[model samples]
Target: MLSILKDFLLNLFFILIPIFIVPIWIEEKNIPKHIKRHLLTVCFALVIILCMTIPVDADREFISDLRQIPLWLGSLYKGAATSMFLCLVTIGYRSLFGGTGFFVTVIISLFIMVIGIALEKKFLALSSKHRVLLATALCTFSGILSIVLAQTFHRIPLSSDISLAYLSVQPICMLITCSLKEMIYKNIALRKRIIRAEKMEAVSHLAASISHEIRNPLTAARGFMQLLEQHHLSPEKRKQYVRIAIEELDRAEAIITDYLTFAKPAPESIEKLNVKTEIERVIDLLRPLANMNSVEVKTTLAPFTIIGEREKFRQCLLNIMKNAIEAMPNGGVLQIYVSIEKQHVLIRITDTGIGMTKEQIERLGEPYFTTKGIKGTGLGMMVVYRIIESMNGTIHIKSEIHKGTEVSIYLPLSSNLHDLTNEEKKLFMAL
Candidate 1:
């Protein structure tokens, strides 16, 4: 009888040690909650080990003969139950915590397990830390109590068998729980990034709408102010005041025009067109402005096609080119390049002009963000941003104070274009 008791104790150790150690090692890097859940699962697995090995019908003569069943089979059953329980626990924890406080929860759980283990051993006569830890502790103590009662009363303990089975299977359950936690955290982070991008797009659209509505009236007002300047007036006295009024109106109109351009709706006439042609058109349009400032235009065009609205695309090029010309008031080379890659069209615009600081580049395309004073509406880059986004493209800007600036645009070769309705198409045709 002593030998049988020794063998049972040895079997318990062999079953429980790996179940505890393996999960701890596997989850070494995991945060506290994950570790806690995993540890709890290991404990719950101990119940399965207890049910499988403990002689359920020790009073029945035939049942004692069944001890020859392989010990490994019992271990495997314990592992499986632990795995299932861990999965359930992980799901529950994730729902409660939303993936935060993993480390904190794990530490608390470990403390609880330690305390629970000591209590179970003191009051309930369960041996081994594995039996008293996490979920396994509850099952192990309950099983032991049932076993003791059955022996004292000389009665069969049928319920104890089921409890023991569940107790042995904690390890497998914890592993499943940890995996679910990781998946939930990853999904939440991805969703946050998507929401941020959507907000940026909405801001760009609002800026564009405001600019468009205010521009035409501002231009007419400025034109009327210029006409008023032509009226006969006292040569010296009224001349200074009139000139100041005209200049102020001109500045206001320029600001309104810049805002309108930045907020203008993307033209619907997008088509597969040569990027080189677009760049050349922008250079030609900006030549008078550049020559007036003595800035030189240079080009290195590689044959590539991009599908986007012609007018909106033109505006993007024009804004960057105009900024470059204004930067090099004393004359500088404005280099434009168009190149093709496997799935994208790349446009690189570089200028040897007064450059901006890192902070300016970082804040580029933000609405009403500018460095050009009253001459800048801070909407140029914002407009460029909206057009590129509407075309499902990306823009990257790099600059260093007194060095120069380079803006690169990456446009996908195949864009998902929304076909215009009949009325929209007719409006485009009219324009």
Candidate 2:
């Protein structure tokens, strides 16, 4: 009797200690995922088998390894494939040792796995608290059902004390282990999320500080350059100097504003904005720059309207088109298309610039991340992302090496106007 309790404690320890260790291995991307799972599965089977042996009854004919914990856990956490693999190993290992009630263990383990897979979809849909409750309940059922199957099918008779131990100790250990494991893993994931948010906040603060320091000087320089243009000597020479000074100052000021937007966005003066009109204005504004690069601008605007501040909406278009134009430093085509779909307005901007790798696209909105050389501070796209998010829109970017890049922005249509049909009003706010 005392041996059974000691063995149960050992079994619980083996089951849980590895829960913490395996996550460490699996989370390390340096290790190939398949290798980690295979290694952990084999390790788990061995540990459970060893744990079951540690508490053999005094009769020496039977081993009371609380080993089923890993079988159920594998199915619940990993998937049907891994748990089934572990099940086969457990059955073969037990049979080799000619264990009593081996067939009973096999039957119960198979039943638990089938149920695990069937429940997996719904199980995952449950909240964390409910999942923990369900896991504990299922594990407890598995432990108890195994004992009943062994007694009924294998005709294994146990003393009342041993039966009580089987009913109480095994189920309780499973319950406690499941609860502890769930709580620990949840806390770890939550801690990671908190750390990521803090890092983004820190970066925003740094950008804000830099923008405040640079804006005044750039504005002063631009004003002085404008005054010098009035005292024209050679008209050509004056025009050239003024152009150079103004371009440099404008670029600097644009970057500064991006940083400011990243740090702290001003309160939006939300109103109905005409998307087609604003986009045409930006296209006209960028025509000079686009011509110098020999890039042709093609537009297919479908007159979509959305709810957002007009100036900010114009800025969004300006930043995107400017990037598209810059992408094609040598002659290429920039296509801007707008359409309505699924009660939403879709804007696609495609540039034949040197395209980006998958890794660069994934880091698109991260601070200081850019494919553009020193000419880009990487804040422009960050502001683009921020504004789109503020307006409840979604953005998707697709690109490949040498194939150019395509950016798609989707925004909900404004519901405020009476011209929109009853069904059409729901299109924008649906996001």
Candidate 3:
């Protein structure tokens, strides 16, 4: 009995190794279905050979092992052609050790294969739990049929303990092996579903972002076009409105180009950007808006360097500063400061605007969350967060209601910045 138990465990170990390995291996390699089926057939054939090569001897009159489990599994999964091939392999291999029992093995194997093929479609259509139950039932029936046929044909005398061991162990082995294979297949299917869902969600987000970003400049251009209908306007005023409209249209074009670059499969362009140069450019661009709102712009920018894509970094800064400017509808100060701290270049933008609550602050970068209500699409900060994260940087926000808000951005200092002398760095900072 102990010997039978050990043999059963050994057979199970050999069978399980390939059962678990083949699916993951083939999935990673992106193997085709037809080829994958053949690979499974070959692997299971090897397992069958291992099981047959080392048979469990009970009283020397009975020879048995768990070879039927793999045969049944292959039949149910790989279709009729594969089942036929495995059947041939089993019959051919068993013929080597000729006996009356060989004929019994042949008869029993054919019986199981026929039943398995008949139920293959039904088994596949069943839900996971039902499939496991049905397969287990089939295996148990096959075991019973084998015992009855063996007694009728070979008349091999077997002790009660050995018979009990054979009956109990084989069905249990079948149940376990079938259950594990089913679970693995189920998990693989679930993972594929999750990956597909994530991809669809990303595409939806990209579409929304492109729509939101392009809408602003287009809206601006439309407003200027509406203003151009006036018949009494000065020549210079009319020309200024036309130029601004054209610039707004050009910005819309640039935005579409940026989004196309983002959606492309090619790699993004990264470069070391001078902090002062980029921030000053954005500040200059928004200077007119600041003046229009009676908001004062103050800066203490240093020529610190950080690594990131030029457009994305500029976009991130623009969103942050634009929000700061908009926050102060009643005309307040927007302070920008930059310095190196603990090997990181820190960008601190402070605004004397109507501030936010802790709850609002925590939800800043979440999609469609905004302090500006209907006037905001709420994607700007989300874009800022994603771009900063891509550059391996972090943003920290501090705000108190009716007082002010400060946003601190920390990015790793560029390696080239280390080569600059302290005096040169100071001179650059002063500039």
- Pitting candidate 1 against candidate 2, the one with the higher TM-score is 2
Ten-residue region with minimum lDDT total, candidate 2 = 55-64
Write model 3 residue lDDT over 128-235, tens digit each, in one string: 888778778888888777777778776844455556677888888888988899889989999999999998997898788768878988999999888889999888
For model 1, how many clashes?
A: 35
Query: Model 2, range 1-431, lDDT digits (tens) per residue?
Result: 78768867777788887777776656655568688778777777877677656653423234566777777767777677877887787777777656566767678768877987887678767887887778778877876777676677655565556667867887787777777768777877887799899988877776675575466557766775766657656777667767877776777776778877765564368888777888999999999999999999898876657889777778888888888888888879999988777767899999888888989989988766777875677778888898898888999999877778899999997754467765445543443
- What C-alpha lDDT does candidate 2 achieve relative to the native structure? 0.76
Cα deviation in Å at residue 389, candidate 3? 16
Best by the lDDT measure: 3
When 1 and 2 are scored with lDDT, the better candidate is 2
lDDT measured at residue 157 in model 3 versus the true structure, 0 to 100: 46
- TM-score for candidate 3: 0.61
Model 1: worst 10 consecutive residues (lDDT sum): 61-70
What C-alpha lDDT do the candidate models reach, one value each? 0.57, 0.76, 0.83
> What TM-score does each of the candidates earn?
0.47, 0.52, 0.61
